[model samples]
Target chain A: MARFNLGITDVRKITGALTEKGYPDFAGYALMSLKLSLEKIISNHGFKESGAMVSRIYSDDNFTDSLIDELSVETTEMFRDPSMWRLLRERIFPGIFGTGDKIKFWLPGSVSSEDLVSLIILLKESDLTTRSAIILTSLSGKSLDNIASGVFRSSKMEVSEANYTKFQGKGELSEYMVKEGGKFFWNKNLFSEVTFSLGKSHLEASATCVNCIIFRDKMIYMNLTLSNKMLDVICRSLSGGGYFIIGSGESLTHTLFDKHFSQVDQNEKIYQKIR
Target chain B: MYKAIIIGGSAGSFQVVTRILSSLHKDFPLPVLLSLHRLKHIRSGFVEALSLKSSIPVKEPGDKDHIRPGIAYLAPSNYHMLIELGSRFALSTAAPVNHSRPSIDLSFFSAAQAYREKLIGIILSGANRDGAQGLERVASLGGKTIVQDPDECQVPVMPKESLKLTGVDHILNSSQIIEFLKKINRNALD
Candidate 1:
């Protein structure tokens, strides 16, 4: 019952701004989250446009990075979900990709390379690296640059290393990255087959006949409308019976996608493109 | 109507949760969302263990699972589970808060945003201070707050932190917590 400044009018203005930029469901799905992010921006970098009207500051570089960072879900540890990774290693990899088969993996909204490290290490250990090609795409060119640089904040190294240990990943996980002052830069050589693109993302690709398409935690950041759009794009990208993985907590029961992807290992949230 | 029951804890709390849950039947009226800290890389059947201990059906929720009554949903390991706008669970692999992936504070705070005062948040025994601020947030929003009596706790740090941080409605032992829940169920029926 406390008075708050943000109301319907501010939502309309911000919604209008985002819609004008061709994004959907910001008003519905991500409104509160966006408002929370803007609140943090105001708290962090003093308010340029005060109280309920953060539309003006939405385009600022710092503000934009903060928004994407707030919305995107990329703090995955190396082998974060052990069962899912184990499933991938023990079952999904062998079941999907055969010998001499080239891997055209479509990884969209991969702002950070933690999940990529887990997947690539899987590929490397599986000896699929020689036949693999990973396409990492994101909306922000800046984040892609960070991914390309292969550097993670030094503070995160401890947790990532610990997770790698739990993953039973052999050799040194630290060997994958070199520490430069406060940041740990990943070895570019490790991702020799990975491609990073700024615009015209993997989701935009039509009929991408690929081995695996990972559209994980990206949906959690997006509004329902955008998530549906991305889901449709993912469905279009994968051929019938191709491997597709999503965030384990994500529900793909949206009626539009139900006919497209048959739930395989529902607990792991892996779905096979049935159509 | 109360939309959900949010429980958070870490080390030494599982048995307490199992004890509380065992007393509740499969027809328990509220959906229980748990954001317990767990090892990120180890594959432990923690939910399965709890399911066996309790009559209530327990499962680690997938991303965006509809919040439903009569079932207890555990936050998936390596993801910070959130309550989305439409009574759905959204998982985020965002940076670990308090060095925990399925951070208790994240669940309590995000679930508070959706359910507001129509939710119950309970903090139980644990080693870390993950859920203290979150329990405070729940109480401040007019939602009910309970913490395990730290004296009875196997590891007292978590509940002790909650008691210190917030004006919790109850500081109960495991049996008392079950009684509290049964009382709620009875009140709902009445």
Candidate 2:
């Protein structure tokens, strides 16, 4: 399949078509990013053109989920940014443990299984596996299933192992995995206590509260309007004095909710809700 | 008139980048976006080193940060910097392309689409062919393309690859690259 560029006009048209078909409104995504994603999705899926891709997405729910998965970009690796994990282990987790309440974490949207597996390892190492509860949600059921399975590509292991070294894990990351048919699969029991939900609306509908909300790197794809809307939901879900971690290159400083949180770690983009 | 300038380089392009940034007019009229390969783990020093002689302020833009004139935005380590529709920056943690996270091709691809004929893309010295396809996209989009003269490059592989891929608007050495930018600035001002 030959690669083709999706111009801004094409992006807007596809976004409109998908939303009209009852798919989530992705019109708020950054146009250039969406354009590139659409281009790749078309080429990778061998869609002869954008119109056919859109038609298939409109008719097939599973294909739409796959498209969402691709658009979200599966780039996360285990223990990504080891310093952040180290900080969580050495300082943040201990502080949360001191609150004398069960620790809860909410990861909204289609977070990668690598991230979930990494968190489970952290919990096990800290001996807090039974004391913490995690809520994971995504627009795609396939993504939720992926998180539950805990299988990941071996290609990412090299970088992940290096990150684990920097994170100073108690044992090698490989020690926690069973290699099967060239893929690394973690024990599914590690997520035995996790709660899985279908979409972002689940967080709001349940009025779920969390001790920390890890919604990192996902907002860069959203426009300011959608970002702020999601921030409102995140702020509501986070209890006062709770932690909010984001991507290092992302900032809440310009958002409408900046006044509600104070920066705890500038370089790591960690924030604490003051109100 | 050029709305922005993007330069992609790796390996031996640091000194070349520093030279160009140092000599660019302090009030340069367009935003400068840079995607240079760097050590992912050691993040604090590259900006400081580049800013040492730069008359214009250099920064690593946070995700969604709005683009501004006269400022040079360096792609953050471990992320792909993309130009968004609203003239803001969008950083992605997508897997590295061509074994590089701050892949020059990814940056140039997005910028060419966003700015079209108003964009200026330049590929500098590097040891890989990461920016070759990107220069081709820029040329196809009607954006101006440039490559550091391969003969003058410390590692001629990148520029040579770009030249092989696209007919760039200019093949300039270090000083000539600066002169070209200054000329663009002067034209914008006039």
lDDT of 2 at A81: 83
Q: Pairs clashing in candidate 1? A: A150-A186, A249-B62, A249-B63, A250-B63
* Model 2 misplacement above 4 A: A1-3, A200-207
lDDT of 1 by residue, B17-67 (tens): 888788886678999888888877544587878888888888887666678
For residues A69-178, what per-residue lDDT tens digits would candidate 1 score against the true structure?
Answer: 44454666566555677778777888767655676888887778777877888788778887788888776666777788887777667777776665667667877778
Question: Which model scores highest in lDDT?
Answer: 2
RMSD to the true structure for each prediction, in A, is: 3.8, 1.9
Please state how well chain A of candidate 1 matches the true chain A, as a TM-score. Answer: 0.84
Tell me the deviation in Å of residue A184 in model 2.
0.9
- Cα lDDT computed for each candidate against the true fold: 0.73, 0.84
Candidate 2 docking band: medium
**Fnat of all models, as shown:** 0.55, 0.69
